[model samples]
Target: MTATSASTTSAGPAGVDVAQFADVTASDASLRRFLHGLPGVDQVGCEARAAGLGTRSIKTTAKAQALDLAIRMVDLTTLEGMDTPGKVRALASKAMRPDPADPTCPAAAAVCVYPDMVATAKDALGDSGVHVAAVATAFPSGRAALDIKLADTRDAVEAGADEIDMVIDRGAFLTGRYLQVFEEIVAVREACARPDGTAAHLKVIFETGELQTYDNVRRASWLAMMAGGDFIKTSTGKVQPAATLPVTLVMLEAVRDFRAQTGRMVGVKPAGGIRTAKDAIKYLVMVNEVVGQDWLDPDWFRFGASTLLNDLLMQRTKMTTGRYSGPDYFTLD
Candidate 1:
């Protein structure tokens, strides 16, 4: 195992309970076998596909291309707080429509709006095949009570969200309240689980910008996985000095290590500040080199971008015809 640098934060969160999770029992033998079973190209296979992949960093660049199925998880921060239920619904519908001129315009993974807009999104996506994801649990700043957070999660799911993105109590985690952070995630996971027999994917955002150290990021990733994060994400995009390559590398390796120990595949998403095709590709390459190419699929990887899709469309258009395309051609509006 690669040892990470020591954390500079003074042991995240106060009084967090850590020993309550059982998923930590997932052993290395089981995890390694599971990772090997997943499909992917090896170093040689990567080399073979690299030439056709279009970029020298095929591992990285491939993400934007494969991201035809991406979900732009955006916050509906309506000005003047004017989003009535109906207006919120319409906003979500508009957010999900993809550009047909682009071959990559399959369907978005979902329209991630506010909790109140989930039902609207669920209705908007309809049989149209997109999912409805909501950011819950005192989002942007997870400073609410446990009950309120859980209620926030339940309300979003009840409102028809297919998935939930919850913020980890960074204060708790940074203060070494790992156990409290773990418990908060576990409660939300339990609430989000389909008691009616369905299951919802949960993406836990570490907001790596605040963790301040690769070691802490690595430790936090491990804790989140142990507590049951279906996907581990870099930031909420609300933090400054957003998603950096080095921080993402730390998170990716944590996923790799978690898979090595748990026999499960946890996804990774680098949100916030990722606005260019090149930036998206860099994340793709990091996953390829660190986690292996099998995770190249949409199921194992995701990008929480707003402006990223447009840049990718423009780049793809330019590449196909050998010329530049106007920005208005791919308006995310």
Candidate 2:
């Protein structure tokens, strides 16, 4: 697949050039044509590539380093309805110190929770360098009206969330109402801004399982980036087949191509269904191979997970002390 170039100088939201993509998002037809015209995924080839990369192994010192990097790249998430302020505080504490036994262990990239929990998380993680991320736009369902969605985003931002993860209207996108989805993302991105001028970073969740095909994943990635999303995320962790290796591969390719085409970089987050340290390592390998070192940092790539941290801690302990620690040693998420 080749990167498509857009030429126009005017600036748009999130530093994107609006005029550059003006022709593409001019209307529903134009947006659909552009998204459809993009390269299609070769399912066999894509899955094959993911499988091959998954087999690449790290060992000894390299394995230890990979474990540390993976720990830092985690967005320690807890989105259950039963979540309490105390639970969020505990989660935030864990995010700041994943392995309390080992002070050398790196803190996670963020503590993700519902909008109502952002303030609790913020208070728990004050001045810790770890970010507070809130899932908005009606979260797992993204079924609310645009006004409600924007208000959700504003609530999170106002509550001191450093990042906002908004779900797109997959219903609209699937029905070929690409313009509607695009506009909603743009609006939410706007709502992430604080009164102090610096805005919470926006992570657009496509809930890729609902998107169905790899080709649609690519289309959604581009649409979110074009609409000023700082990051394009895979799932909401509430659906089947969340964040598969092949699907993430497609998204990695999209961000890589997008940066090449527009000179703007967007982050990718693969959420849910990734539980083991080994599984996280495979994703790290894929990111290295697919997009190179540029996306190796937490700022560019994050694993949206709750249970993955425990396994990583276990692996770290085993590597450090030459013995395996049972899962009981770590606090459950």
How much does candidate 1 score in TM-score? 0.76
How close to the true structure is residue 284 of candidate 1, measured as C-alpha lDDT? 68
Q: Per-residue lDDT for 109-216 in model 1, tens only?
A: 556667877776677667865667788888878889999988998899888877888999999777666667766787888778655756577889888889876667
Global lDDT of each model? 0.66, 0.91
User: Once superposed on the true structure, which residue ranges of model 1 sit more than 4 Å away at CA?
Assistant: 1-97, 102-104
Error of 1 at 62 (Å): 6.6
Work out the TM-score per prediction: 0.76, 0.96
Candidate 1 Cα lDDT to native:
0.66
Top model by lDDT, which number?
2
Q: Which stretches of candidate 2 lie over 4 Å from their true place?
A: 1-14
- Count: clashes, candidate 2: 0
Task: Tell me the tens digit of each residue's lDDT in model 2 across 1-333.
Answer: 223354445544445555567778889988898999999999999999999999999999999999999999999999998999999999999999988888999999999999999999999999999999999989899989999999999999999999999999889989999999998887888787777667899999999999989999999999999888899999999998899999999999999999988778999999999999999999999999999999999999999999999999999999999999986999999
